[model samples]
Target: MTTSFAQVMIFLGLGIGIIILLTAVFRVHAFFALLIACFVVGLGVQMPVAAIINVTKQGFGHIMQSLGFIIVLGTTLGVVLEHTGSTKVMATYILKRIGEKHAPLAMSITGFIVGLPIFCDSGYIVLSGLNKSLCRRTGISVVIMSVSLATGLYSVHCLIPPHPGAASAATTIGVDFGRLILVGMAVAVPATLVGYGWARYAGRKFNNEEPGQAPVVDLSLPTPSVLLSFLPVIVPILLIGIKSFIGIDANKPVPDWAGLFMVVGDPVIALAIGIIMALLAVRSWKKSTVSNLLQEAVEKAGGILVIIGAGGAFGAILAATQVGQHVSKVVNLQALGIFFPFLLTAVLKTAQGSSTVAIITAASIVQPLLPALGLDSEMGKLLAVLSMGGGSMMLSHANDAYFWVIARFSGLDMRPMLQVYTVASLFMGLITLLMVFILSLFLL
Candidate 1:
């Protein structure tokens, strides 16, 4: 069916709104909620049900085709690092170096670094555990730990290539990975600082400061040698960075013969390699049995698989809505007078909730305009890249899975959660946008 511009707008808005509400308010799992929403839109638009199912599968298939292994490897590796106590060591070491007064800063920095290769969800869980320990020991609030963890994990995940959202957005928008990361980092520091301030203030206000409460840290958990824990997290990022910088598409892939390594050696394999080496480093003071450790990792991987697959399904439904074409037409020079790209991405992110989807959707709509909008020019391209990325950071709420996760783990009520996580996200996005605009002023 040829969806008219107006018709597409109406349906797309309804579809996007419903999916957001369903994901946020009713607390539906985003994957299933989005799946059902896709069905509704396809049917509402008068497409046959059969086509919807096929398209949904096709949507999932496409996401998994590129991202499936990365998600698996990343999550599994994060679990190993967390379970075997590698991340803990790194956090403590950072805390020691920087001091707990700067724990939020430390975690924020860590999140930025780890976010590149690790999935955000896994990174949050792993790093938050360590944050809580430091806070508990040092008399800090959960927000400090939570925000630090979030800032750290979200930084690289949103900005750098290789993370699914960034990678997907980059591929869709035609930005070079090496180049995007360079631009992303320039914007990321300001964003991180913005989130850090939000977290610090929130920490002071709401560190759960009752007269007395049970500690958040589970003291029974054995601490691994900090050196050992550092390796797994560090190695994969180093390898990927090396490939990106020194190799830069020479196809001189990290040698597969190097201990069964492949570009796909994944976070799991990477962490495992690090874990075994860490084990060797100590040789005596071990806590977990191999059987139990592997079992826990597998259990953790199950949730990662489900949530990720569901997100893929939701993305497909949006694609089916053909919102991209409608958005492209509506935002054109003849129509909306060629407004800013940052605003475009922010609106999509707020309206739609999935940053990856928002960025990719916005980029696709914005790409064809590169030439017409002068976006084909170097500064214009940079503006477009940062705008799409920064926009995806806006208005994170119940519509966003990250919002819910932060809400759940940080144990904040919805309103307060919004004040913190949602606002923090907006703060991050705005700072990124401003910096990009300033950069444009100079470059353009």
Candidate 2:
């Protein structure tokens, strides 16, 4: 079951090559591509054929078991917010309070908070109309607002839990979810600020054109109250954070009130509660409307679920190959510290254009090396999780779906899109990694 260092390198190369060829060159769907990569790695590492099947099945099942309810509930909450105009209400409220001069910052904050529950793509689509409105009103370039919004969404999507990428990475690496959330928030704030800075500069330089008439959007829907709109996201975060504070353990005696928080504070249950709150926040809660929204959410969740499961399978195969142990013997990753995970994930992300896949695979690769790398403590593992997230933020270019979403929705030409959003992603990711490194010195 042991792999030689040379065999590990070859397996790594073959695995990554298959992923790039299938997903990048042939345009195979990422789910199938990751599954294929898993099988290839399993075979290349000399796993028995029957064991490969069992490993793949177990890996896929394990990830889905950990992530299925969280992803589904999170997406459903987002769907309700988007379909019911709650997202818009929050966006509009933030813009009005911040006024025109600070619209980019406002949008950044909106994207950060909203992104906790919604996927970045859906969050961008939900808020694009609002972004357009802000541009027209403030005479700020759509480029700045778009980049700011994208940066904000990207920040939380990669780092924050219940966002699938972060959640799966945390789960895969066996980090505490609540601690990851806290650390992710710590890193996200500065990274988002870096993105906001880039957005402001890009707005002034590349998009100084006079604003045109804003596109017309339906304003007749009854929006949820601001407090009600925020409850879904805010409550779960608070509950989970509280649980982290109390330190749930069987060894410790639990009070009754603490027991209640423990049940509600579990990530799955908290998100499920958020889903119900989101459903209630909808202005008209007709059964048909609810049914349709659930269907749409499920459809979106299905694609993400498969990709995550496949990524898990891929990681499982890597572990089976004992690549981590081989790499540990060959490389002094302890010297590189947190940067090792970040660099590995950045390469995967830049190559394959999926942050979730990058995080999952990187975590799998790093999990077994934790002791060798001196990242075996809870704090160290949390840092590793955040490091992978930081890496996933790098180089969001043409191959990235989010790149196209910002391009098409924001009406940015290819050149400016590269300059603004793409370059900004690089900056944000680097700044985040730097921040994570600095924090690790103190915490780890």
Please provide, for model 1 over 143-206, each residue's C-alpha lDDT reduced to its tens digit, 9 standing for 90 to 100. Answer: 6667767866776666665565666555445565556666787688888888888988866777
**TM-score list, all predictions:** 0.73, 0.96
Task: Supply candidate 1's per-residue lDDT for 239.
Answer: 52
lDDT of 1: 0.64
- Candidate 2: C-alpha lDDT: 0.85
Give the alpha carbon lDDT tens digit for every residue of 334-355 in model 2: 8988999999899988998888
Q: Give the per-residue Cα lDDT of candidate 2 at 305.
A: 91
Best by TM-score: 2
Provide the lowest-lDDT 10-residue window in model 2: 210-219
Model 2: lDDT of residue 236:
89
The C-alpha RMSD in Å for every predicted model, in order, reads 5.3, 1.9
